[model samples]
Target: MDRYGDSTQKPRVHKAEVMDEISSWDYVIVGTGPAAAEAAVAIRELDNRGKLLMLGAERQLPYQRPPLSKGLWTGKDTVEELPLRSAAEWDGLSVQIHLGDAVIELDAGARTLTSASGRIYRYERLLLATGGRARQPELAIATLRDRVFTLRNFQDYERLQAAARPGLTVLVVGGGFLGAELAAALSRQEGLKVHHAFAGNAPLAHVLPPTLQKVVLARYGKAGVQLHPQHRLEGLDWEDGSVRAHFTTQAPIACDLLVYALGMESNLELAQQAGLTLDKGGVLVNTELRSSDSRIWAAGDLATYPDPVWQEPCRLEHWDNAEATGRAAGRAMAGRSEPFRHQSLFFSDLFELGFEAVGRCDSQRVLRVAAPPGGGKAVVYYGDGDWVEGVLLWNVWGKADAAREGIAAHRPLMDLHWVETLET
Candidate 1:
């Protein structure tokens, strides 16, 4: 048995894979998300004939979600274009693909899993890559009609793409990455009412500092996005194919569509139901990505592995982090005893302002900024006393390598040079 702990929870078995006699599979991954797919691929790369199987609840092939909020709103892309890999590729790799069937229960003691379709799968090693789910308010907007949408998967985006039209009012809730990206996508459409609401002071205040937050908010404000900060939606009025939303401290606002960008909830029901341990925030895994049970292993959004660099349990929601973590977990499961180590990194583009951040943002530290007057781009470094901990940049592309290197090297501010790289 193995165990790991996070935030405020006792170490529970994150994974425990006992040998199964019914059938033998070297590795059986339980998700088709980035983590699952990457793990499967890595397993194949490690052992040519390892006998692997991948299970996905969604019928669609593994696809990227980042573009759904961007291209779907713009009508420039479709679900068919977002698949992570083609069926031919999966076939080529001889990966057993089970779509639309969700694993409902795990028998860690017996090293088996039961699917919703009543199929029992036996495995020597198990990987739980079940990613997180986009959260929503307790109740639907009173003003919400069938047209209101939230893009959680390809199908959700398909409905949202069909609903976004000219003269439509798009009310975006939350100001984080999803909300901002969805709002930005709507800004490109003409004659659209794009109103953004947030409970915080500015957009992405959790991940960015006040100065950078202001820049993002200002950019959105200029895009004709009505800002309503410190506001909470009380209810929505739906009538005659339109919706009117009631606010806490303001008059009711009417809109044609509402998109909620609230955070995400890690999918841990299967594990929790099986008596696996869970941290307050997510599944807890140690350096080996092994749960207390030792029979199961978890990675990606579902698994909160320890970060060797930060010396804490950190979960990243970025594409690269997910891929790297998945690969590491897969390698570790395939008999590699290397420790899992990955630094968090994320970036986004909004018209004129490009935002990027490395490591976790520490609000307690001082932020040193490097930007000229009236320059649209800047890099903010987060330092804990004398050592640089993280770096964030705006209008700074191709410089992420330098920023990452600087942070990793613990370069002092005195030794760093900031040269203007913006094209004049």
Candidate 2:
């Protein structure tokens, strides 16, 4: 059942006397996002009588984030595509929500939280669906720094989308997935010149290995994107018509606009203050998504939980991982003791070039298998010798579920042996 709201019906309200008894809730979800929204639904499924209170950092209702990065810019997706739940739908859940504010302080021992506005909330059990912040360097030209955008939330997307125009030179600073995707999408514009300036040698340096990089680089080259590798931006100079991105060693690259896709930093101030364990994978959690403090459970990109699929601890920022872990944490909070055995399905849309990937798609793997090319569509299997760890399908269609299952089984390609060559 959709826990957000029912448009066809009216909401039933409890009497003033009954409302007085509901001072606190059985569960308090502090970040009203997809994770928190899903958590509320999952909690209702587990215990109908459980009181649920949600606190959002923003006033707007939680929305889908994937569109903000890739789809929204292309005009293929409308503003309606951004929302995960409508105001009416979220109201239908009967969960008390305080929008436009975040929990600023948390006392795990006392099981209480204080918001930015100084309102205190108490929870029996909690879910840290707190999101991440945009990772970027401080730019100069304070007045025109408005041109230096970072795509994270809806507002940022709107600004960048409106500003990026044909003939506009955009310097995207980051070598990660978001940076590359933005470059690819923006480069597709008729006259827009897109320059990808990153510290890494190649785009998607943090992820995609040589096996997948070759194909991706080829696509970028075909698209005519100016790749500026190993340019750690030292400063920025704002011109009357453009902003110049300066590097410590390389020549200054000036652009009409600059948008940094430098990546995201997990919002961990509250989590860290609460003394939750932290690592490279954000906030650490167990197999069941329970944090060091038993009363708190975390999900979404902020959580670095055990990935049973890959037998490693992973902190993923994709929608699939967030949806999976959010529901899992909600269910676990409701007494489900099973480990997270689900695979994280991540997808990136670069105009026509899109991919659905699972565990261990990044570099540091020596294995790959390139099948025979059929009509420009190629299937590449990557993983250890025994199993298919990561699968890349070039121009393939409708194979997401099959790809995930294939990776899970770790099935090695039979007709083709594992090799690091794209020669088909």
**Per-candidate TM vs. native?**
0.86, 0.85
Candidate 1, 266-336: lDDT as tens digits? 89987786577777556788887887677678888888878757667777777777787788888888888
Clashing pairs in 2: 4-89, 5-89, 387-410, 388-410
Summarize candidate 2's per-residue lDDT along 1-424 as a digit string, tens digits.
2222222232222211223222566888888678887888887788777778888776556778777767666778777656786656766766667665668899888788887656677789999999787887676457567788888876677678778888788989888777887888788677899888888778876655565566667777788888888899888777667788889899999888888787799999878888999867488999898999998999998999877776677898988888888899999987876788888777777657666666676465636545464544555556667566776655565666676666666656652423222233
- lDDT of candidate 2? 0.74
Best model per TM-score: 1
* Per-model tally of clashing residue pairs: 17, 4
TM-score of 1: 0.86
